[model samples]
Target: MEVRTPWQALTRPLAYPRSVWPWRSAGYLASSVVTGLPALVVLAVLVLFSVLLVGLPLLLLAGVALGGVERRRLRIAEVAPAADPHRVPDVPGLGAWLRVRAREQATWRELAYAVLHATVLWPLDLLAIAVCLGLPAALLSAPVRLALDRQETKVVKAYLVTSYPQAFAAALLGAVLLLALLYPLAALAGARAALTRALLAPRETELRDRIGEVTRSRARLVDAFEAERRRIERDLHDGAQQRLVALTMTLGLARLDAPPGSPLGDQLAKAHDEAGQVLTELRELIHGIHPQVLADFGLGAALADAADRSAVPVDTDLDLPRLPTAIESAAYFAGCEALANIGKHSGATKARLTARYDPGPARLTLLVQDDGRGGADPDRGSGLTGLADRIAVLDGTLTISSPSGGPTLIRVEIPCPPPSA
Candidate 1:
C-alpha cells in the first residue's frame, strides 16, 4: 500500500484522522521546536567566529547534521523519502568529501534551512500546536474542575461553568473545537514539509548534470556497438573472404585444365560461378555491416563510394576534415541510408549529396536531395528512423523535407571536434 503524506491526507476528508496522519503532523511540528533551538544557537556562534576561518567547516558540519535531522522529521509528514541532492566525492577521503560538500549548493541550502527553521519556522509551528491542541485540552478539563472544586469552574479561563450540564456542554464544545483545529494543524505541517523540500531538493543544475551523464552513457553504448560491427566486418574480410577467394581460384584452374565437353569440367565451371556469386554477396553484406572504405579513408570517401553504388545517379560535392570516429561513422551511414532510400523508393533518376565541415563551429552537415516522388515517412518503415536514432546518440540532428510531390531532401548535422593526427 502506498502511504499518503499529510498534504495528500488533507484532500481526503474522511481518511485523514482514521489514519496516523494527524498525529504525525502534530509530532512533526512539535519536534521542529525541539531540534531548531540548538541548531540556531550553534549556527549563530559559528557565523560570529567565521572570521577566524575555523568556523567554516564547523558551520558546514552543523548544517550537514541538521540536514539529516530535517530529512528524518520530514518523513513524519511526508511518507515519500526525501532525495539527497549532494554528490558523492569523486576522490575518497575526508578532505575530499569536505571539499565537495563545501562546493555543493545543497550544503548551502541546508545551512539556510537550518537558520530559517531555528529563527522563524519553529516558533510558528509551536504557536499552531498551542492553538490547535492546548486550548482545546484546557477547555475540555472544565467538567473535571467542576467536580473537584464542587462549585463553579472556568472553561479556558473565560467562560464560567456552574452546573454539571454546563460543564459537560463546555467539554463537548472543546471536543468539537479540537476536531476542527486538526485540519489547520495538518495544513501547517504540510506547508512546512513542502518548504523543506523546496529548499533541499535537487536543483536545475543537478538535473542537467544527470542528463549529461545519461547522454555520455548512451554515447558509450553506441561506441561499443560500432566497435562490435567493425570486428565482425574484419573477421569476415580476413578469414571467410580469403577462404572463398582461394576456393574460387582452385575451381577456375580445374575447369581450365579439364576437357570442354566432359561432365566433370561442366560441374567445375558451375561450382566456380556459384562460389563467385556467394563471395560477392558476402562482401556486400560485410560492407553494409561496417564498410572498410569508411574505416580507411574517412566519411567523405565512404559517402562518395556509397553514392557511386546507388542505382540512382548521385552527384557528390563533399569536403571534410578527419573527424571523431563516432561522428564519421554516423554521418557516413546516414548518408548511405538516404541514398539507398532514394534508389529504392524514390522514382527519381538523379540525386545529389553535399557535405561540408565548419571548423569554427565544430559541425559537419550532410544533405541528400533527390528529384523523386517526395512523400518519405519514417513511420512507414523507410529505414530513416534507425538512422535518426543513431545520429541522435552523437547529439546530431537528422531532418527530412518530403512533401507529397517531387524533390525530397534529407539533412543531417553532427557536432564533432577535428581528429588530431
Candidate 2:
C-alpha cells in the first residue's frame, strides 16, 4: 500500500472515506509506514538512552515532554482545531508573546498525540507492509518446482506443490484476503486521523469577532445620536428661546415709551433689529440640527429647502418613489450635509443634488456633487460626519470623494426602510 504525498496532520481528517476510495487503505497504510518508520527509529534511540544510568532519567523526561508537545500540536495547530486557533492576532503588544506561557494548557496535549503516534503508527505500517509484500511474493513463488518432492526455498527448504495454475490460485486467494482486510483498515485509519485533525486544528475566529465589533459600534452610534438630540432640545429651550423672549419684551417697552425722532429711542430700535438677526441665526442653527420641515411637507420639500439655502446655486434632480418617515429623514439630513460641505469648501460654481429609488430591493440613493474649489476633508469635523452617523443608524452607507482642484461628490445609500424602524 502506498500514497502519493505525505498529508499534513490537519488534512488527514478530511480525506476521502475508504469505502469511497479503493486505494485509501493502501495509501493510508503506506503513509503510516512512511511516517511511523522514522518515529520508531527515534523512539528506539530514546529508549536506548534511558537504559544508560546518567542519561536514563533525562531521556525518560524528554520522551514524555516530546509526547506532550506532539499531542498539543495536534489539538491546537491543525487547520480545524475544535477550539479557538487564534492565539496571537487578538492580543496586542507584548501580551501576545506572553501567551506562550499558557503552554501547559496547549503543549502537553500535543505531546500525548506524538507519543501515541510512536506506539501505534509503526505497528499499522508493519502490518500493511507485511501483508502487501508477503502475499504477492508467496503467490508468485508457487510457480517454481524443485527435485523429486519439489522443495522450494524461502527459508529452510520446504516441500512445495509445483503446478503453476494451482500455485497461482492459492497466491491469488492470499492477495484477495489481504485486500479485503485493507478495505476496512484504511477507513479506520482515515477516520482516526480525521478526529485528530478536528481536535488539533486552527480556525478563523478573527473575522467573526470583527463583524461583532462593527455591530456593537453601530449600536453605540445610534445611542450617541439620541443623546445629541436631547442636548439640542435643552439648548433651544433653556438658552436661545429664553433670551429671544426677553429681547422681544425689552424692544416692545422701548418702542412704547420713546418718541420716534429721539436718538435714544432710535438706538433702542436698532438694538432690537440686531437682536432679531441674532435670534434668526439661532433658529437656523437649531433647524440644521433636526429639520422639522421634513415631517410636515415630506422629503422633497425639505430637500428643496436645503438646496435653496445653499450659498452656491444648487440644481435639484429629486424624484421620489415615496419614502417612509425614517428613510425620508435620513435622505434629508444626508443631502443637507453634503450641500453644506459644498458651500463651505468646494469652490465649484455649479452643484447638483439628486435622489432616486428602486423598489425591487427597496432602497434610495442621494447624490450631492459640486464643481467648486474642491478638496473637502471629511475628517476635519464637517457636517458630513453627522450625516454619515444618521445614515449608519438606518443601516445605510455614506461615501465621499473630494480631490484637490474642482470637484467634490458625496453619496448616501440607505435601505428604503430600516428593519427595526
lDDT (10s digit) by residue, model 1, range 253-335: 99999999999999999999999999999999999988988899988999999988899999999998788778888998899
Candidate 2 local distance difference test against the native: 0.62
Which one wins on TM-score?
Answer: 1
Any runs in candidate 1 off by more than 4 Å, and if so which?
Answer: 1-200, 203-212, 359-362, 417-421
> Which pairs clash in model 1?
none
lDDT of 2 by residue, 1-421 (tens): 3342223321344453333343543554455555556666666676777577655434434444554343343332223324432244333565554455244333444444545667885586567556664555565555553232354433113434555456566566656765555445554545555545443332333455566679778766655764676478568967987889798779979877989889988888888888888778877777866666775677888999899988989999887745676577668877877877777667668799998876656688888888887778767888778778778877899998877885788888887542231
On lDDT, the leading prediction is 1
Clashes counted in candidate 2 amount to 28
The runs of at least 3 residues in candidate 2 whose Cα sits more than 4 Å from the true structure, single-residue gaps closed, are 1-217, 220-224, 227-231, 234-243, 260-267, 321-330, 373-395, 401-405, 416-421
